[model samples]
Target: MCGRFALFTPIPQLTNKVGAVMSERDIGPRYNVAPGTWIASIRQASEDSAPTLEEMWWGFRPSWAKGKGTQPINARVETVATNNFFKSAFAKHRCLVLADGWYEWIKNTSPKQPHYLCRQDREPLYFAAIYAKREDGRLGCAILTEPARGSSIDVHDRMPLILNDDSLESWLAPDLTDKETIRNLVGHIDADLIEHWPVSTAVNKPSEGQGDELINPL
Candidate 1:
């Protein structure tokens, strides 16, 4: 599950990369984004308009949930399309959750080392996500996760569904609603494209510190 992530790329750079207009609200760099926090996401302004950046709460709560329970931060790709809690959003509210990198822990080892993972080229990463509008008129989103593939499995058994450049158009196309086609578009990024290294445990304390030093190689 993608419990924590970082998006320190300057706002201009990120908006340019995704062909989105930056929102009026200034969302400065975040080096330790946690669940329930407002995070950056890209979605269509309308069915026929260009994509735009928006900030959404990280946990998902469907309208039917009635604010009664915990909202999930991650949804399994294998079951997302069929699960009642996520199916409706998965089919119609797909979104792109922006990030520069994410953190995962190697649980099999002592002390569970935390590793920062990102594209070797340092380009921004986009995770497949689905959003829902609650009765209160608030937006919430959840990242999609799949069983680990390639080198990422060495650190954890699950990883976010990172989209490649070629798939972005289809994934974000507002008019596309075929479930089978959407499912087919879900693809795994080759693990070799990413690089990782152990980082300071300071990242574990989100309230205390969150800066470049958190991702620095230890």
Candidate 2:
């Protein structure tokens, strides 16, 4: 699951690359982003226009969410198509969560290592995500997770559903009525797009903002 990630690209550069209009001008560097914080995401507001990149809360709590809690950070790809909390958003509110890389914890005899995972070619990785607007008008996005691919699986059971430029069209433009089409797009992340390496575990805590400590090797 994509519990942590980073986006250091300037908002204008990201807007052009993702074919999105910038919603804010000051969305600067985020090297140690965590869940439950505002993030950058791209979603088409209407059929005719390009996508919009805006700051979104990194948790999804649809109107149907019960009781008193914030929301969920990541949605399991295995059951999102049918799960009560995510199905509707999966069909209708899919988005591309923009990230330069993500940090995953690896178990070891020593201290748990934070592995930074990203595209091998040094491009931003867009994770297949779903979003929903809450009663108070907060937009939330949740990264989808599937069985690991590439070398990262040795460290974790699940990895973010990452998309390259090839699959970007299908992922960002899905037929809401066609479940099969959506499922196909969801499952076909290119394994060749990713690479991983160990780093410091300063990212274990969310309170720490973007800092060199998070990316520095121990």
Candidate 3:
């Protein structure tokens, strides 16, 4: 699962690429974007219009969930259609979470190695996500996870749903709410389009003193 990622793109560049209409809010650069934090996303409010950019809190906890707090950072693609917490959002509140890169742990014989996977051409990665509104008025989003294929399997079993320019409309269109369509859209698994390398574990302690030195080759 993609628990950590980076999103430090310039506001203008992001708006230009995705054509997202962003609010006046600016959160600045973030190297380690953890769950329970707000992240940028392009979401379509209805099935008839173009997508709009919005800031979404990166977790979901259905109000019916009997607890003080039960946050969700991801929604299993297989079960999202039927799960109460994600079903409604799956049908209509789809979104694309923007990221420059994402991190995954590769457990080899030596130790757990963390690989920072980014686009080979250094382009941005757009992840398929679903979101809904909370009673408090904040938007909640969750990343969709699917089994990895080919080279990515060597590192992790599952990867976030990635959408390129061509696949953006199908994933974001609220009208195409068919389960099989979503399954077929699992994409060709473009792991080769990604660049990966090992990094120091300093990223583990997010609050301490992690900085650019953390992404350096270990």
Query: Quick one: best TM-score, which candidate?
Result: 1
Q: Which candidate leads the pack in lDDT? A: 1
Candidate 1: regions farther than 4 A off: 108-110
- Give the lDDT of residue 197 in candidate 2: 78
Instruction: Using TM-score, rank the candidates from best to worst.
Output: 1, 2, 3
At residue 113, give the lDDT of candidate 3. 68
Residues 62-119 of candidate 2: C-alpha lDDT, one tens digit per residue: 7656435768898988899899778888877888888788888886635666888877
Q: For residues 25-86, could you state the per-residue lDDT of candidate 1 as single tens digits?
A: 99888899999889999987457788889999999998789888889999999899899999
lDDT of 3: 0.76
* Candidate 3 lDDT over residue span 1-65, tens digit each: 88988777776576666566766787577777888878988887776566787888888764455
Q: Which residue pairs come into collision in candidate 1?
A: none
**Please, what is the whole-model Cα lDDT of each candidate in the order they appear?**
0.86, 0.77, 0.76
lDDT of 3 at 10: 75
Of candidate 1, the 10-residue stretch with the lowest lDDT total is 182-191
